[model samples]
Target: MQDYDETTAFLGQWGRFQQVVFFVLVASNIPNGSGVFSVVFIADIPRHHCLLPDVNITEDWLHVIIPVEVIDGEEKRSSCSRYRLDVVRNLSAQGFLPGRDVNLTELQQEGCVDGWSYSKDIYQSTIVSEFDLVCSEQWKQTFTSTVFFLGVLVGSLISGQLSDRFGRKPVFFATLVVQTVFAFVQIFSSSWAVFCVLLFVVGLGQISNYVSSFVLGSEILTGHVRVLYSSMGVCLGFAVGYMTLPLLAFYFRDWKSLLLAVSLPGLVYLPLWWVIPESPRWLLTQGRVEEAESIVRKAAKWNKVQAPQVIFKDYSAHVDEKKTPSIERHSVFSLLRTKTLRSLTLILCLVWFTLSTGYYALSLNTSRLHANPYLSCFISAAIEVPAYITSWLALRYIPRRVSTICVLLTGGVSLFFIQLVPQSIPSLSVALEMLGKFGITSGTSLMYAYTAELYPTVIRNTATGACCMVSRVGSCIAPFLLELSTFSKFLPYIILGTMSAVSAAAALFLPESFGRPYPQTIEEMCQGRRLKFPCLPPKQRSKLSSRELFESKL
Candidate 1:
């Protein structure tokens, strides 16, 4: 019975057909990068203050009507309240100048009677500016982003089941359309509520399309092509897309314009519907043998190989053999059915939760860094290029446990020290912040490969899915974490740093999966058979082989 791999071996490794699919699928991820991180610009709050109505005072004395407070170590006019206009007018008429004859603090303060004034130097408009989401309403900014990620979590959970039932190509295209249409609709939204609802739908489509593209590529590509597609192609494409966000935001400046600009590029991707093909593997899984055969034949012909007359023959028998191991399929709850699995699941969740939270916290804070928001965001996104490359190298050469623990620790240490960098040297703070992001980014990339390796194949998807969902919970909480800065300037960094450090320590207890065969069952995991290095004395090796020979003879 020939497996799909044996049947497709004649198509040759890294052929033109595989190359086409690789590039096309990788191209799909470029837009996803933008969609994922565009929130940085869309929700950023600019410098603002309470608006002062028509007063017969000079522009230089506008400070007389507003109180100043130190925020993040900078003396800035307060955002929420202003000195009573009547008092200020009476004082100004009496020639009672601010800081001269009168005490500014002594004046009664009240909320902005005429609304707020937003600084347009960096941004022309954002959701914060559009909806007055500042001061007491600041939670709305972070909550909106959380709502989007919540949508991502829901979308991720359903897309897998939907794609399994409906086929990969249809779900992929449907989500792509959903993403495009809703993204555009967000630009036209008349209110924040409408915009947020659209944003949630956009998040749904974003993850759905991304997952479909990934699954399609994995199913269709064979051998090293699949590895490269997963490790380098998709990650680098995402970084490229993320890097493009700052450049686009720099040009568009206005929130509406930036949203429209970044989103319209997805429309160009629509043409891929005509050229890209469905996953033949998915087709076979659904018992569409003829359809699967046609795609395989097309792939072979595209690679200049002769198409086989019979494909997937005896596949049912081979599938039965393959299916026997998983006949008693376990649900996600089964991950905790054993003490060992339960311990591993809990540790993995903590690790995933911290890494995901740290990653997003650093990403969302990019705009707040003491530099040009665009440059800061670009640096944050661009750094992931080298970070991912470093992670790949580490995964190849170093032990998985060592690499994961070290990366998390490095991120933790960097974030812990960021609080110590004196405000006198803003560059140092920014540098440390970016360094922390670099470490977390490397760890984030490593976790996907590392976590999958740790779980046995039967429950691997379920275990990883549960852990990833935990990460989304982290994602949901991160923006709110950023809001903690309102309580204390160093609180967010301290909290994220603590999370990183704790997770790194938890990683030490995880079994190392490096250079070892993946365990096939929960029993193998419970036995801890494959977790150790295979070192043995020469005498021991000889004795073991001799014993095996004697047993075979008996």
Candidate 2:
């Protein structure tokens, strides 16, 4: 295979291919909004019980029905009665009954009641008089939701490492199939245990969508385009998912329908096996030069250009030759040995952790916002469009260090102000929230680009994945953090803000890689050197331009 200086050409091919790939990958993340079901399940109906009209009573069984207004002030067509008799009948077959095994507190927690608060009179008179059933089994619904996230956290870390070690396309294909199967399986689950297990599997597979998408986009695109395209694509998916979640919850009140609706779209990705190519960059790292060359040729063909006779050589071959035969591959612990790399990893991890925690907590807590939850989520997400655009512009024109530090600092400062401002001024709070969203989104987007630039190719994915694992740790804790008392509503935001600022400070110690070729090995990275063409011979050394030296080294 020939080597060509075809970075520009490869980039053009990447630009066109990424659009189609982006759509399929984005759809896979829709299930991430499954929490919308939990919210809708609780909030849609009131807790009050009103008498049912024209109903006959039977002596053998007692009937208690709660009339819920689906459309306000329209009783004839929009009002429906949730019957406790049906619940009783269902539970009776399972050896459970109403008052004997179930309590008012348990029913209220499961959203079986009709009002915001429990009615003591109705609870004591009607509920106690009804048949007995064990309500503790209903807690499984909450448990399933919690299990889904646990699966997500574990799946994300595993997918990240596997994608780096094996390849993105394989993981993408495998996960899509698994996600599709699990999604459909939930629709027919007979027990809560089965539903929870299936949901966990679905979450586990769904995480690969984000990990593979980000890694694939990063591998193909260069510089500002990489940052802008990757972040905007993912965030756009998130926004769409968020908007669609409530609607899905409303339309498919049953968990089965909701799971099917979200999971079915993932099947479209299965055909990607034919379209998505294995990453050429990854192939080069693994010393599969022939395979890398073939992919590069195909990429050039897609771009309507003839392949160059001598394309870029595989630099990994040379690096491997220098290593001692006895030396094993470095573990995650070895990343900490380099002072600069260690600081970069720690800082990036902190920033990702902080950003994810704050982002999710606010997102989940949107229900508490005074305005409509759907509209509020839409507005919050809309603000991110400009944030991504600004990130692209800053990365393209501004110095890498300045752009990163400024965005991080701005996000932190805005978060602090959000806490100081009073919620009584709803409009001001909304404005500040938008500002905070913009800052954090911009900072988050910038961090991906910055982290990629800081690391040499050998351990790039591993390093990024390790940092992502740390971020997931924060995501795991976000729920508990947000559940803190209302008096300390600002506590999580304050912590997030401080962490972002600290990361920005840490970014100061890292070297900038803008306008420079990516380093292929740790030796090449630490030497701060570039490749230069031989004025004499392969063994001879001579002074040359930095870019020329870097190119020759590669």
Candidate 3:
């Protein structure tokens, strides 16, 4: 049978139907984009010190109660501990004022007994402030992100197979509703435990919707339009959502309000269930020929073109095609069946893991950048605009392998030089970080397209989902990577840089899939990929072949 693109040729590429699906889907992603990174600001660790008890002393002397500690290479008032209140009270009662007769060095410190007095300069009330996830409880803050990712991990594990087993459009709307509802409900959570539980539930749907939408768009759109949807279009939509976060946070300046407001946009997508069609390519894989034909007919109508009366034809798998594919419906194990496939799976797993870690690490680290958190986050989100656009152009023009290597290395090297920059110029460090974000963001955008092209329709969602499930390990660990700053300020950068740089080598082995059609079956998948190394022994007199050795026991 002809490829879906060829089969549906009359339904013009870049026509009105495609345009609606493209933009509506992209718009649907804005809320998701905002939701995914909401934790950045919602849990922001504002400038804070222990709350001071009311005393008959001037406010100028309050700094004396909070002992100076060197944190992240800067001497600042300790957020977790204050000088012994009894000692300070006694000193003041004895007419020995702060910085005069009392030696602060001699005083012992105690943990905040009253509570924290968070600075309202950045956020009025973040989860960090409201939940007191500070100092000793900082692990809660990190764990909160990890829990959400664990939910994402679950989503990754299930969404693809569910999309493959059920259908992309149904799963997309279902997961989107879950994500939006749970996230909104989380805003009203009265306690941190309740909030984290809801966050996990929200996560269950978070990546599910995203993966389904991405796969949905990938399969529905064809040709260069598919490439644009996978890379620039989808990612730019996400950037818009991400960009919206800081702006919302800037106005609300409170965690609950910002997150609550972000979820409202998701409600607008409810009526769009009819606008986006189920992926015809996916339907063809499932043998839902008639339904697939109907959707394409609608598409054909919208494009004002004629579709063939018989849109699909039966295919008794050819000799070679029959040999290449296993089951019409495949599970995750299908990935490990052949040596080439196993190798492909492993390399892509590594690539996904590293990219996720590096991308989210840069993203989550925005709040930590030595700048205004809102502006820093906005710049971080804004950088993706160009990163994705340039990435789309690069993948459209440059070899896929070259673009992947360059972006990963650019991000890696940018991160490497960050520690070398003098702290006196924080803007320089921030600029380097954004450049790093730029590269990773571009690389991430490129990976979505590249990975989609490398697999067949039957297992494409499964392949992508499984890779993402493993990637959740990296993303889950990302928040703690920031905790490495406790060891050394530059330690996190060093680790992120090294991972990004080293992982670039994996791209060397990936098939350059630029301008390639999405593989429709296992046979097509194998045919499209050529091993970089021709290491197989010269064919034996018996005529053993490379493809034979890869797929079957010789």
Off by over 4 Å in 2: 1-146, 189-196, 310-331, 529-554
Q: Give the worst 10-residue stretch by lDDT in candidate 2.
A: 125-134
State candidate 2's TM-score: 0.71
Best-fitting candidate, measured by lDDT? 3
Candidate 3, residue 77: lDDT? 85
lDDT of 3 by residue, 216-323 (tens): 998899888888889889888889999988888889988888988988788899899989899887766654557877898898899989887777644322222443
Better model by lDDT: candidate 2 vs candidate 3? 3
**RMSD in order of candidates:** 6.8, 9.8, 4.7
lDDT of 2 by residue, 85-127 (tens): 4454555556654556654223421233332222332122111
Every model's TM-score: 0.85, 0.71, 0.91
Question: Alpha carbon lDDT of residue 43, candidate 3?
Answer: 81
Between candidates 1 and 2, the one scoring higher on TM-score is 1
Which candidate leads in TM-score?
Answer: 3
Q: Give the TM-score of candidate 3.
A: 0.91
